[model samples]
Target: MSHLFWLDLQNLKRIQHLFPKPRGVARSDDRKVLSGISHVIRNGLRWRDAPAEYGPHKTLYNRFVRWSRLGVFARIFRELAQPGPDGKTIMIDSTHLKAHRTAASLSKGGLKPRAIGRTKGGLNSKLNTVCDGRGRPLTFFLSAGQMSDAKGALALLGSLPPAKILLGDKGYDADWFREALAERGIAACIPAHRGRRDPASHDPCMYRKRHRVENLFARLKDWRRIATRYDRCGELFLSAICIAATVIFWL
Candidate 1:
């Protein structure tokens, strides 16, 4: 039911340009990296527990890190992003993903606040993600569970310019958010937060269409990896989300 997974390999050919180099010394091509990374996400397995076909767990993890540090995943989203000058609408939302018990970044105190906090879900991490009108992710952010959905909107939506419209819910109704996008000429359609004195700026019809973001979460959960945070580092967890989004985008 997800457009990304439902897309065929032939349709996914466009992705080859982005993942030209496969991870691992023994891996021969990008296909291996794609498969190796995809396998981990779909099954929610540990990196060190990657299957034999993936060459080495460290290799896959290293490659993921190298690519992430270099902004490869962000580039993929930028290049493959749908809501262009001639495309459909855009939507944004965040979802909480519970970290694995033994996940590295988890700790009750010290510097692990990035991974541990209290949300409605108790101890968890929140994935702030952007998607097109049809539920395809365009960008994402990984913050502590206590982080608000509105916290990362500026970073996520500010990156892309030249769009007809953007969508969101009551969580993103900030005056600066409107001014931020207005400066770039992007139509900020986020709904008003509670107790907002200013009138609403979003269209109810288009706002209803924001359900695509929820559907995107549903599809992403199909990949157990994203459903749970097994990675200790936020960077690694985000990389997995990026790769998973890529797989879905290309699907």
Candidate 2:
């Protein structure tokens, strides 16, 4: 395994227990299988291109697909991503990833909307995330690139730990959303949209910290696979995102 995976032996031990024991011949070389997963996400390499050190590329690819379907990576992310110190405030934001054409073509029986959208950037996907006060990711949601930032807002909010204040840009300033936050006893610190009939009030000082979520996105994109979409299946791509978050952010 390369030095890329920061999770040490102890952390690895903690992570290993999350999955039920793998059955069959594929169960061997679990460590290298995981290492190969990390490698592919870090380098954004195709399964066939994974280095020999990680193990056979076919095994790695099959393992990744199996894990994706089983939500193993997502479980790892949830278990490891500890809540940030300032739990009272949650920052929400979204970023777009340019999807390669390889990710656009689907088999005849494939699913629709795969979270890819046509945009000024061509084919793209939206990655919406919620971060804690210190910019640690709490939850993530993916939608088509052209989807409004607020499209996935409720889903992201639902996954977050209870927080007192929700910070966001003008895009999240909808009346319904504010009301939704209020119902949970959370203060909406989102800036009012320019076209609002009556502008809502928010603390400007607190809003400045919205940059923390932006910074989180910047760090996530540092993973080449995340910077550019490659997987045709949305679930697989999301699994990749979870792997990156667990290894790079949570670790």
Candidate 3:
């Protein structure tokens, strides 16, 4: 068997309560199934390529897809990412994920939001995130790759945690966004846009800390599944991201 990653007992215990209880006939072992799922996602391998020790590849794939559709992974991530009492400083930013060609097809009728778009760099999706003072992810939003950073910020605005200050790059430097933050009693440490007639003043010292969110993105992209989009469904892709964040940063 190839080298594989498994959730140790401690980490498994952290999320044990989040797994749904089995009904009727008992299902396969949760640990083995989850480990197989993680292995496939971490290595960006196809379901059929999973090693045997994790159980039949079909079991791993079914468990992941079923749980993702049920929002089990999202709930786990949310529970794990709850803001601490001292989470006063927060950061926001976005990163793009390149979509594989196989990800182009959507289900018939297309009611679901694909979140994939064609940019000069081909098909892509954008992940916008907010992280606490220590760079732990708090919440995130997904959008088409062509969406503007300011727009992405707006989408995540309501979900921003309670914080005294927010750190962001100039991409978030809009009058409305600053006004919104002001209304929420949060200070913005964002630099002014190049074309602004009245440049906004920001503390360069505080702005330096904005790299924490970038660092968070760097760590998240280390998961190959997250670095490249393969799921045709946007929710499933976001679930993959949430699972990775939970295991890597929260667990």
lDDT of 3 by residue, 33-111 (tens): 9989988898999999999999999999899999999999999999999778879899999999999888876542467
Tens digits of lDDT, candidate 2, 182-208: 989999998887777899999999989
* Clashes by residue pair, model 2: none
Off by over 4 Å in 2: 1-7, 107-113
Put the candidates in TM-score order, highest first: 3, 2, 1
Deviation in angstroms for 41 in model 1?
1.2
Worst 10 residues of 1 by lDDT: 1-10
RMSD of each: 4.5, 1.9, 1.4
Candidate rank order under lDDT: 3, 2, 1
> Of the candidates shown, which would achieve the greatest lDDT relative to the real structure?
3
- Candidate 1 lDDT, 107-217, residue by residue in tens: 444453445456676667888887766777777777888877667786686555456677888788888777777777668787777776776667888788888899888
Runs in model 1 lying further than 4 Å from the true structure? 1-13, 16-29, 48-62, 69-71, 82-88, 104-116
Report the CA-based lDDT of candidate 1 relative to the real structure.
0.71
Q: In TM-score terms, which candidate is top?
A: 3
* Residue 124 lDDT in candidate 1: 75
Which scores better on lDDT, 1 or 3?
3
Q: What C-alpha lDDT, on a 0 to 100 scale, does residue 228 get in candidate 3?
A: 92
